[model samples]
Each structure stands twice: as structure tokens, then as C-alpha cells.
Target chain A: MIKVQEEDFDVGQEIKNLTQENHAIGGVASFLGLVRDIASNEEISAMTLEHYPGMTEKMLAEIEAEANRRWELDASLIIHRYGRMEPGEQIVLVITCSKHRKAAFESCEFLMDYLKTKAPFWKLEETSEGGKWVDARDSDDTAASRWIET
Target chain B: MKILYFAWLRTTIGKSTEEITPPETVKTVSDLLDWMPSLGENYSSALEKRDLLRIAINQEYADPEHVIKPDDEVALFPPVTGG
Candidate 1:
């Protein structure tokens, strides 16, 4: 599953739904990324993330498909929230289920690395100082590159 | 011809995408960037880092020397940052 929207999601509820149909699954790995409260030391009020409408969905689906191809995952879920969102909001969620713990763990991490580097999302944070655009970090690219060595 | 600006490039351009007929000799992303004088100073300034900008032809990422066809879609975006 791939979703990009403005609404919040329930992490526990989503995890349950993703793993419910497969009773044979022995492991599930999940990740939740919350919007940070700090923006240049100013209190962050909200953030509005803009994405290439059709392209964002397409790119994420391709990334997920790649992950599935590389690992033995039975199912995967990716949810990303866009638009103006306040602090404490859930910005992203990832879930992976497999027959074993290694598959679940590795797939979840692999998907996250791809999402961090390949997903097309522009993040803008609204802080007490004003709205500021975010930049792509070299560390993120490095994180993704690490997986290539495996 | 279609042109797409993504991520910070879109912010600098103040628009997402635009359609226009290419001028004579417009064949590469570099050529298009050189001729985008009407997109505003910020666009010209933000696009300074040609090496860092990952471009695409249609839906696939392309090289700087990639040939652009009349009906092709071109996208310009920085390295993606998300988790």
C-alpha cells in the first residue's frame, strides 16, 4: 500500500491491518517518523509538504516493488502525510511482514532507505520565525548507499 | 514540450510545470536551463548547481547530454530527502 495525504494515521491500527490476513507470518517490522518540533531553534508550528501529484505515488510504488524484489516480504505498507501539519503529527509510517524476523527487519530498513532518497517530497516547515524550505542532506544519500554494499 | 520543476526547484520557480514550444537549438536540459530567462531571478540562481540537479526525460532520470524530443517530458529536481 502507498498513500500520500494530509490526514493523520493510527500506527497500531495500520500495523494490525497489514498483518491480520497472514496468520503464518512470524515477524513484523514497522517504523514511524514524527514531524520534529525544532526548526532552527524556533518553535515549529506546522509543516506543508508538496509533492508531484501523480509522480510521487508512482515513484513510491516503484521503490516498494524494488524492496519486494530484493527481500522475502509477504506484505508492505507505506503511508506519508502531506499538506500543513502541526508538530506531534505522524508524518510517515512503514511496515513489513515476512515469515522470519530477518526478512521483516531487512525489508523494512531497505524500504526506508529507498524512501529517504527516491521518494519525491519537498518539505517546508513553518516555525515561529516563518516558513523555511528543507534541503537534501548528504547523510541521507550515504544511508541509502550503504545498502548497495550488501 | 513539457518542463517539470520539483522539490526546491519548484519552490524557486514558483510553479510546478509548464508547456512551451522549444526554440531552435533546444535539445538538452542544459539548453533549456540557459533559455529560461523568464522564470525569474530566483530560478536562475537556484539552478546554479547543475551537477547536483538530477534531471529526467519522461519518467526516467537522464544525463546532461541526453537528447530531448519534441513530445518528451523533462523533470528537474534535487536529490530527494525523505524518510
Candidate 2:
């Protein structure tokens, strides 16, 4: 399942829905990203996330498909929210369920790494000074690069 | 062709979308990037980091050398920062 929305989601409910139908799943791995209070020495008051409407969903679906292609998984879910959010608010969630722990773990991580680089979303930090667009971090690119098939 | 800008590119360029027909010389995305700044003063600074800007042709990530058509939707923005 893949969902892009403006409202916050219930992580517990989502995980339950993902694993309830699959009796073959032995393990589920999930990751949740939250908005930070501090960024680049400035105290962030809020964050505004923007995305290409049609493209965002398409890119996320492709990321999910790639994860399933690489791992033996029964199910996977990705929920990403865009719009104004405050510190500690959930931003994204990735969940993977498989017959074993390894596939679930690895694929969850892979989905996150790909989403960081390939997803068509941008974040703007609203700080004490004013709002500024967040630059793409080199670390994110490096993390995503490791997943590339050689 | 339809050109779209996002995030800082949209704010800096002062518009979200526009329609224009490029000359025959602008065959690829890189050529379009080079041609954009010449169209207006705002584009010069908005597109300062021409090499760093990411392109999406018809809603998928595309390279500078990607071929473009008059009906395609071309978007230009900075490197993605989402997770």
C-alpha cells in the first residue's frame, strides 16, 4: 500500500492492517521519519513539504515495486505526508513484511534510501529567521548510491 | 512544450508553469536549460546551478541528455530532499 496525504496517520493501525491478512509473514520491519526541531543551527518552527502531485505517487509506487523485486516479501507499505508540520510530527513511514526478518529489514531500509533521493518531494524549513528551502544533503545521496546495482 | 518549476525555482523564477516553443536547436533537456536563462532575467539566477538542477520529463526523473518533445511536461528543480 502507498499513500500520500496531508493528514497524520496512525502507525499502529497501519501496521496492523499490513500484517493481518498474511499468515505466512514471520516478521515486519518499519521505519518512521519525524520532523526535527533544529536544522543547520537555526531553530525550526515548522516545515512545509511540497511535491509534484501526479509524480509523487508514481515515484513512490516505483520505489515500492523495486523493493518487492529485490526481496521475498509478502507485503509493504509507504505513507508520506506533505504540507505544514511542526517538530516531532511524523513525516514518512515504511513497512515491510516477509517470511523472515532479513528480507523485511533489508527491504525497509532500501525503500527509505530510495525515497530520499528518487521521491519528488521538497522540504522548506521555517526558522526564526524566515523560511528557506532545504538543500539536498550529500549524505542522503551517498546513502542512496550504495543501493545502486553495479 | 510545457515547463514547470518547483520549490525555490518556482519562487525565484516567479511562476509555477508556462508554455513555450523552443527553437529547433533545443533538442534535449540540457539544451532547454541553456535556452531558459536567455528568455528572462529571473531564469538566470533561478537556474544558476544548471548542473545541479534535476529534471523530470513527463513526470519521471530524466537526465540532461534525455530527448524532449513539444507535448512533454518538463519540470526543473533542485535535488530532491524528501525521505
Candidate 3:
């Protein structure tokens, strides 16, 4: 499952729901991303996330499908929030469930790496000086690229 | 075709969406980017480094050589910076 919204999400509730009623699931691995108070040398007061509505969800679903194909997984979930958010807020969540720990761990990391690049979302950081659009880092590209089949 | 811009591209272009019909010569995404500068100064400035821009044809990431059709939804933006 995938969700893009403007509201905050509960990490505990989300995990419980994902693992419930599935006796086949032996382990669940999750990753949660949070907004930081600083960027480079600037002090970030807030950030706003923007996304292509129809396109964001569609791409996310495709990414989930790809993870499933590559791993032995029972279920997976991705939730990303958009719009203005202050520092220390939750920004994204990824959970992968499988019968064992290895698949869950690997797939969770893979999902995050792909999400960082493939998702059609942008973030603008607001600082005391002014607001600026964040640039996509080469490190992020390299992280995602490593997952590519060679 | 329906062309859309997002984030800084939308702000720089001063609009989010537009409808345009390109001539037969504008057959690919790169061709459309080159032709866009002819529209006005905003197009030229916003599209200063065409190679830095990322495009999507019908909401999927597309390459410069991707074909364009009159009924497609073409979107342009900077490289994604999401997590």
C-alpha cells in the first residue's frame, strides 16, 4: 500500500496494522524519515513538500511492485506526506514484511533508496534568510543507482 | 498536448499548466524544449540549462528522445529531491 497526504502519521499504529492478521509474517522492518532543523549552514525553520498528485501515487505503486518482485515479501507499505511541515516532523515511512529478517531488511532499504530518487516529490526549505528549493544530491543518485541490475 | 511545470519551474514560468500544439518538427522531448524558448522570455530563462531539466511523458520519467504526441501530458521539473 501507498499513501500521500498532508496529515501526520502514527508509526506504531501503521506497523501494527501492517503485521496484523498475517500469521505468515515472521518479521517486519520499517524505516521512518524525519525533517531536520538544519541544512548545510542554514537553520531550517520549516519545509514544504510538493508532489504531482496523480503521478506521485502511480509511481509509488510501481516502486512497491518492483520491491516485491525482487524480494520474498508478504506485504509492504509506503506513506509520504506533503505540504508545509516544521522541523522534527515525520516525512516518510516504509515497512516491509516477510517470513524472515533478511528479506525484510534488504527490501526496506531498497524501498527507501528507490523512493529517494523515483518519487516525484520536491522539498523547499525555509530558513531565516529565505526559502530555497533543495537540490537533488549526487550521493542520492548514487545510492539509488547501486540498486540497478548490472 | 497538456504541458505542466512543478516547483521552481512553475514559479519561474509563472504558471502551472498550459495547452500547446507543436508542429510536426517538434517530435521529441528535446525538440519541445528547444522550441519552447520561442514562446517568450520566461521560457528562455526558465529553461536556461535544458539538460538539467527532467521530464515526464504521461506521468512517467522520460528521456530527451522520448516521443511526444498531441494527446499526452508532458511535465517538466528539476531532478527530484524527495525522500
**RMSD, one per candidate, in order:** 2.0, 0.9, 0.8
In model 3, the Cα lDDT at residue A8 comes to: 97
Question: For model 1, what is the alpha-carbon lDDT of residue A104?
Answer: 89
**Candidate 1 residue pairs that clash:** none
Candidate 1 off by > 4 Å? B38-42
Query: What DockQ class does candidate 3 belong to?
Result: high
Q: Write the per-residue lDDT of candidate 2 for residues A46-101, one digit (tens) a residue.
A: 99999998999999999999999999999999999999999999999999999999
Q: Which residue ranges in model 3 land beyond 4 Å of their true spot?
A: none
The DockQ values of the predictions, listed in order, are 0.67, 0.88, 0.88
Once model 2 is optimally superposed onto the true structure by TM-score, how far is the C-alpha of residue A38 displaced, in angstroms?
Answer: 0.5
Task: Put down candidate 2 lDDT per residue, B1-83, tens digits, no spaces.
Answer: 99999999999999999998999999999999889888889999998888889999999989889999999999998888986
Give Cα-based local distance difference scores for all models.
0.82, 0.93, 0.94
- Second chain TM-score per prediction? 0.84, 0.95, 0.96
Q: Write the per-residue lDDT of candidate 3 for residues A36-115, one digit (tens) a residue.
A: 99899789999999999999999999999999999999989999999999999999999999999999999999999999
TM-score of model 2 (CA atoms): 0.98
lDDT of 3 by residue, B43-82 (tens): 9999997788989999999999999999999999998888
